[model samples]
Target chain A: MAVTRETLLAFLSKKTRADLSKIEDGAELFSSGVVDSFVMVDLMMWLEKQTGARLNPADVNLDNFDSVQRILAYAASRAR
Target chain B: MSGKPGIVVLGSPRSGTTLLRRLLDAHPNIACPPETYLLSAAARFLHADQFAAGLRIGVLDGLSFAGFEEAEVLARLRGLTFGFLRDYAERVGKPRWAEKTAFDAFHLAEIRRLCEGHVKFICIQRHGLDVAVSLRDLVDKTGGYVQELHDYVRRYPEPLEAMARAWIDTATAIAELADSSEDAISLRYEDLSADPAAQMQRVFEFLDEPWDDELVGRALAGTGQVGFGDWKTYARSSVDRSSVDRWRSLPEPVQVKLAQICNPTLERLGYARIESDDDEDDADAARRRYEFGLLLNRMKNEDS
Candidate 1:
């Protein structure tokens, strides 16, 4: 199954302990401190587990994971 | 604590800091409260010199407010940060105050410089697997002490691995910082848990407090901080030896994965690696070496 925004949301909401409903798919997670650098590494590792997407340095740039929508797009792009 | 004496407890998340804080707080003259989160909460007020509004801003440490709102708001209330804590201890009539934060290790020097009076630094270390498992348990809660590894909770291939990475990175950084700091004492969680009275006696002596058999007795007998978190260590008076050697209960594969991600750190910290089949360990080592060779080959190909 293609990983969806809801899938990313559920995983991140649990990981961040954030309120699931408030996290719009478009919210700026990285810039907003909802996810910081150390946590960002863990998120990349989790993304790989959920989507089988291996993240290199390039994939971790803000464009790919700054928000839920971007993360979903990045994961889909890298999925095997 | 420029004019008065205080204690700061530092540890990896779940490394028994709260327990230690409660024990110290149990002292008659000492008041140890829950985390203040000072560094992170007040970082927006800092200037280029790391001071908030011309006053020294070295009070908070381990906060990653790299680029936050440059609100001058944090500057206006700079005195309130340390003053509030100081006045609270005075109002409560306790001569001493203690703050516990795992990130204190990152800002030890700055904190020591910020304070004019003597500040005793104490740190605790725990095994990665046990901390990881406990962190895993906190994945579902609304509010828990898993404040340290909040991002490492998830399914296989990442959770334990990410936990291992966090443990390694943090332990290495904190250990080095603690080793280099003056007036700092370090203890292992296993040693403290196994022998509370003796370990705590050493701690009491370090803080220049006369050890009362009563304080140790109180810490062991469920006197205070009972069920504070309501999870594993919350409100429990007695240390459960059951938490020792938890890696044995983890699946063997997960154990190996933890060792792989955390091997260098575990080895550095003198924690034993998980036992594995010799053939399997050898094969995995060979595979890693092969992967490195492959990466080198790719780089060479690109260069050519």
Candidate 2:
């Protein structure tokens, strides 16, 4: 039930100090300056907290966490 | 204004980014500084805020910043990277700034987003064969290549295969950016050598700079050679077409291997394929298409 789109957006909005509605679901968060490497590490930690699963090094790339939608999908796969 | 006309110059290593950097840095109103591990370093450090703090206090070499507490520096390079660049421009009284990085092709989205609004990217490319030859020279000369390239060279049985793989990866990454980004455009090294001034005009126009044919022409003729010293040499003031086809001097089978691995990309980039024979095209075209499809599939496997 965790790692929903809203949860990710909330986490991002808190980290970036930008309005939640400002960033599109599909917008690349890192590229768009919403997250940096530090925030990315925090994001992974957040995902693991939600899914109770560790992300393999291979699973961590720009593709997985590039956007809010991709992060949700990636977290869901791990949750399953 | 427009954030000092920020630019990110990127492409395959040795594919003329350094050459472009040299030329752009010569501009009176521009400051195109050397590379830093802004992206890759960011990837490694978990506490980006701490890392940024560490960097500000000069933690990279394991030192502390004098004024700010070690814990006080912010964690976001994406937020502060352009700010630093703008600061540098202001200090130098320049109105423009750029960074030349071979790795930016992989981080294009991050760069576009970070520099948002006023950024433009100039991605330059060269023939893959030439790139392979140059990379091989670098590996031989330096006893190492970039880490990503080290894997390809060490993993492949044939060095040419590895170089081909590197070239394709670099070219494809840049291609995807060219296909997708409105703020990015590609240029050919060949054309630049053939005519530096004209090519520079195109670049300047794209960058919204007042074209100074005299400045560009003078820089190319000899004034820009700073104390690059141990860096051996860089682009000369005059166009040197000698390196353009130097890869042809590579052994025949090696040339064939490069063509097999790189010719499609080369063609797409508008360079002529290395044609050994003219009359065999019909048969070769059919076979190359099939072979290219297989190569692409193999590439997908490798990527995944």
Number of backbone collisions per candidate: 5, 6
lDDT of 1 by residue, A17-55 (tens): 576656788888867878644345446555666676556
lDDT of 1 by residue, B176-204 (tens): 75777777788888998888778888888
What DockQ does model 1 achieve? Answer: 0.02
lDDT by residue (B235-281, candidate 2, tens digit) is 35555667777787664435665787788888887889876421322
User: What C-alpha lDDT, on a 0 to 100 scale, does residue A63 get in candidate 2?
Assistant: 74
Q: What is the lDDT of residue B227 in candidate 1?
A: 28
How big is the positional error of residue A61 in model 1, measured in Å on the Cα after superposition?
Answer: 49
The superposed Cα distance between candidate 1 and the true structure at residue B296, in angstroms, equals 41
Most accurate candidate by TM-score: 2
